[model samples]
Each structure stands twice: as C-alpha cells, then as structure tokens.
Target: MTRCRLCGSTALESVVDLGATPPCESFLAAERLDAPEPTYPLHLRVCTDCWLAQIPPLITPEETFSEYAYFSSYSSSWVEHARVFVEDAAARLGLGEDSFVVEVASNDGYLLRHVVDRGVRCLGVEPSVNVGAAAREAGVPTLTAFLSPETGAAVRAEHGPADLVVANNVYAHIPDVIGFTQGLRALVADDGWVSVEVQHLLTLIEENQYDTIYHEHFQYYTVASAIRALASGGLTLVDVELLPTHGGSLRLWARPEEAAGEPSGRVADVLAREKAAGLQELSGYTEFSARVAKVRRDLLRFLVEAAEEGKTVVGYGAPGKGNTLLNHCGIRPDLLPYTVDRNPYKHGRYTPGTRIPILPPDRIAADRPDYVLVLPWNLRAELVEQLSYVHEWGGRLVFPIPELSIVEVER
Candidate 1:
C-alpha cells in the first residue's frame, strides 16, 4: 500500500496515469540538445480515508520551482484574476486602517495590489529569488524565503498575526504539504482567516487536463482531502467555492480549529457531488490511463496528418502546461516548426525537451499557418479572438485535450 504522503493513509486509489514526461519547467539549455533526460511517471491517486488527491512522490519542489522560468504577470487573465481576488478579499475581511493581509508565493505582487489599493496593509512571502525581486521593485514588501514553521514564527514576530492569508493556486506546488499548512496556522491571527486556491483534481481528471501534470504540482485536491490535511495543523475549513479560473479550482476559507464555525452547506454540497462523481473511489479513477493516452495519440495524429497535407502547423502559448502536453506527445520542431508566446522571457527561447523554437506572437501572422495548435487550451477564446486573422487565409485553430478538435471562428 503506497501511503498518502501528507496524511499517511494507506488506502489510495489511482485517479489517472499520464505516463512519463519531463517536468514542465525542464526547458533545455541551449548547449544540451542531446543530453539525456529523466522523465517520471505522472500519476494521480486519491486517499480513501482523507479524500485528498495526490501523486506518489516522484519529484521535489526544489527540482521544479527553484530557478523558475514562469512569471504570473505574463498572463493577462491571471493578472485580472489577482485584481479581483484582492478586491473581494479586502471587502470580505473588512480590511482597511489597522488591518493587514499577507500572501504566500505572491508572484510579482500580482494579487496583493488589490489589498494595497484598499489601504489594507499587505506583504508577500515569495521563495523564487528573481520573481521576488520583481515584486520588491513593484513596491510590494516581499520576504524572499520559503514559508516554513521557523519563518512563519519570525514573520509573526515582525508583522504580528496576519488578519488574512491568501494562497492562490500554490497548495499543490508545495513539497511539504503538512509543513506548509502548519505554517499557515502559525502565521494567521487567532480571529483571522486563510484562503487557499488550488486546481480542482476532479475537474482535471474529468476534463482530461493532462497538461497540468507537472512536477511542480505534487498534489491535486478535493475538499475532503484539503479539510483533513488542514485539520492536522489545528485548522478547520469553514466554506468552499468552485471557481472557473485556471480551468477549474477550489477556494477554501478556513480558520483555527477552535474558531471554526459549523461547516457550511456549500462545503457539504461540493463534497457530496465529488463523492458521487467518484473522486475518492478506486473504480472511478481506474480508467484514466486510457483516456490520457488517447489524447497523446490523437494530438500527434492530427499534427502529423496536417503536415502530410502540406498545411503549416504552428503552436500558440509557451506556458509550462503547453510544455508538458507537447513534450509528452513527443512533438519536435519538425512537427510543430515553431510556437509563439506573448511573454518576452519566452519569446526568443525554445521549449524544453521538444526543442521547438518559440517566437513572438506576431510571427504567427507573418508565418500565416494553416492550422495553429492552441497550447494553452484554457485561453482558447482569447487566443482565437486575438488571432482571428488566421481566418483571412482560411486557417483553423486546434484544441487538443478533452478531445482533438478544430474551430473556425469569424472575426
């Protein structure tokens, strides 16, 4: 019995298997084109007792997020999402003079700006040195260190207990799941609340979002698993809400165990729905390997067929998720030719493993591809709308996961 890493639960059921692939951030060095790479099996498992979704240990966060290449500000959608989170949190916390909010992994101070705008004092705990520097430059007070029991105590000493602690889509990225939760307990005020947002594991499996199978995300989550994990650190979940951001995600509101109120109907409803949908049951997750393998096969088939028909095939978005899908599908420069990105840091680089060149998005119109693969399938709408001129040349767009389909939208 492979026990759950956080809760030590022996009853784990396989949710889905994504086979072996390089880490999402394993972008190759320019000189190591032929260097051998190690790819780990990307598998999802659900803890029966705690109802937490996770993968067997395969990689470490130090191997995934340290020396990171991704920046949250690179995406327009995420930036807007941060702005909204800050606004709502400030109002909900009744934050203003004499109130303070703190964010863990506050990349580029993207979300904290909203709290700052409300005059609610704010601070950021960022581990990535480069990204943390960027946040500091933007005038967000950022502590460039990992959030841990020791650091949490030290921060509490300096800032006192935080009235609100926000962690957006970072729970799954943490390597020490229990340690991370414990830190939250130590840092949050006695009467204050903590909100954590994570990609919904059930949605990821149901929608076949294999692109999110990066090493950085060690655990996928459902309400049952999350509540149980936090409880170990003397915290209790009070409410839960499903959000549409990041394909799909869960926003959890929690407080100290003693201060927690009766669990809301909102929490019970989602748990019941997830259980009915077989989120924690073994049989429900057993059929996953076949579904994801089909996606890999179907994508290669579509791109290869398009190539045979003399249609120029290119790619959109240089996101880490895109890297996972493309590399796992065994895409090479010959098949994809080149992809384009809006982020300047990625534009002139090549994707890891696949070695496909990445250029600026403008190059897409210049090349005028007959079919452009939308790598960030989550942003299909915006990409299609922005790149609608592809239709001027009778070009089509492709969305690979969930199913391989092409769309022709009018400008």
Candidate 2:
C-alpha cells in the first residue's frame, strides 16, 4: 500500500483511478513514434489523516520536468494573468528596487518579467531547461534547478534571502510537499512572504475536473490541508485568496511562524467554506470515482456519435490536462485525428499515449473542421475569442469536461 506523502499515513482512500498513462507533457517527435512509450498507473488517493488528495510518485521529477515542453508564454491570457499578479503582489508587498524577488518553477519567466519591468531584483528558478533558456533570453536571470531544502540553502547563499518568494501552480507538482515548503522557508528572509497557488480540491471534485489528474501533479490541496502542509515546514498562513486560474485555485500567503502577522479574515472564510464542503472528511472524496467514470462515458459517447455522423473533430491545445482527459478516455487519433497548438515545440510532435499528431493553429483555418474540441476548457472564453472565425465556416466548439456540450460560436 502506498503511504500518503503529506502525513505518512497508510490509510489512504481511493479517489479516482485513471489507469496507466504516459507523462502528460511527453510530446513525441515523429522519429520517436515507433519507439515504445512507457506509462504508469495514474491513481489518486486522499489521505484520511491530512485530507490531502495525492497520487503516488510513479515517475521522478527529473524524468517529467527536464527539457520540459510546456511554455507559459504561448498562452497570452496566462501571461496577462501573471502580469496582473506581479503588479498587485509588488504593490501589496511594498516591493521596491532593492527588494529581492524569487520565483520557483518560473516557467519562461512569465511572472518575473513583470517584476524586472518594475526595476526590482528578481530571479527565476526553473527546472525545465527549454523554458529556463527562454526566461534567460527574455532578460530574466534564471537558475535551472529543482527547489529543495538543500538547493534552497544554496540559492540563499548565492543570492541573499529573498523578500518575496513566489510559487504559482507549482505546489501541486511537488511530491515532497514538506521539503519544498521548507525550501521556501529557507529561501525567504525572516520578514519575507511565501506565496503559493494550488488548484482547490473542492473545485476539482465539484467541477468534475478529472482531467487535471495526471503524473505531473502529485498532490491537490484544500485551504485546511494547505495550512497543515505549510505548518509542517515552519510557516504560518497569513492570508488566502480564491483565484479563478486553473478553474479554481487558492493563492496562499505565508511567513515564518516567528514572523509577526495576523491571520486574515479570508483564511477563516475559506476554511469555513471547506468545512461546509466536507473536504475535512474522506466521505467527501467517495463519489469522485463515479463522477470521473461518468465523464469518460460521456466523452466516449460524444466522440463515437461524432464519428458515426462523419463529423471531423480536432483539438485546440496540447495541455497536460487535455492529455489526461484523452488518455483516461482511451482516445486515439482515429477519434481526434489531429490537434493544433500555438507552441512550435509541439507542432510536429505527437501527444503521448494517444499519439495524435499535433499541428500548427493555421491548420485549423486551412482545414476548417466541422467541430473543434477546446481541450483546455478552462480557457474556453479566450480560445473562443481567438477562434471566433470558425463561425465563418459554420463550425461549433465542444467542451468535454463537466459533461460534454457543444457551443455555437457567435460571429
């Protein structure tokens, strides 16, 4: 039996099983398509002790992140979101030219670029070489290394303790939650703040966002569970904000337990919400498997009906979440045929497991398929706006999660 990573408890209850799937971001080159692709069981379990939803670490971080394929700059909306966050955080934290900022898992320096624009001293620590190089090219000093207690000490020695440590969308990717949080504590100055963003487990279960369950994300957190995790690393929650990113996420601000800061009312408000939602009990997670199974059935039914009607369907984004959805539903190129992505790195590659060929966005306009499946459904509005011209060809957009539905695009 796999023990829970957070509390080291053996009493882990099954939440949802996605069966075996390749690393979601493992886009394959044409030359490598003939080679065998490795897959691991993608099962999620909730810790009865800590109430943390997590998956077993089937793959190492090096294998999943090194030379990574996902780049943040490709999504204009995401970049703009980062820009807004930097602007707000800098002002709220009273950051100045002398204040040092550090971002962990800073993909393509998307957020830190805004920090630099304000003349603040900032650094990005990205494990992915491809994206780290991009960050460096964009004039953001980046360190290509994973954040751990040891690495954190090394970073603090090289560059003085940071005044603001930002870790957005990285809390879930970390398997060693305790160690990573400790590292955050080590890198931040005594008075500095550590900000973390994680997709709320309540949203995942409520919205049926099973697609977000993949190898890359090891653990999901609720406000209560996140506080427990941070406390284990000698940090105390000072504030919490509910963000709309990643469907629904929690942006938590913390500081060393010794630091002087009162808990914000938002913290109590979110904790009460989680309590009412039953996130504190294992019973809350029991029905998740059934919901995920229903999503699979619904998605498969839609694809089969579309195929029977001779409807040509393609995908919009090659995001990791989309891969989980595809692999979990057992979708192949026969159903999806091909998908398009804005990232040139994925253009000529094939999606892992499904082996669906990925093409450029221009292919969509050239072929003008009858239906387009917006894979990253969280960005549906942005994608709809970008592909509004699809209405010119009488094409409709489809969303598979939270139930499969077809949407008519307005001209």
Candidate 1 regions off by >4 Å? none
- Per-residue lDDT over 1-411 for candidate 1, one digit per residue giving the tens place of the 0 to 100 score: 288878787987776666677777776655666778788777777777777777666777666655667788877778888888777877887888799788998988888766777777888998888888888898888998788878888899999999998988889988688888989988999989999999887788788887887777888888888888788777899999898877889999999988997989999999998889887677667777789889999999988898899889999888889988987788998899999888776766678778888889889888888998998888766677887888988989999977998999678
Candidate 1 local lDDT, residue 117: 70
Model 1, TM vs. native:
0.95
Candidate 2 per-residue lDDT, tens place, 8-87, comes to 89988888888999999999999998999999999888888889889989888899889899899888899999999998
Which candidate achieves the best lDDT against the true structure?
Answer: 2
Per-residue lDDT for 231 in model 2? 93
Clashing pairs in 1: none
Count clashing residue pairs per candidate.
0, 0
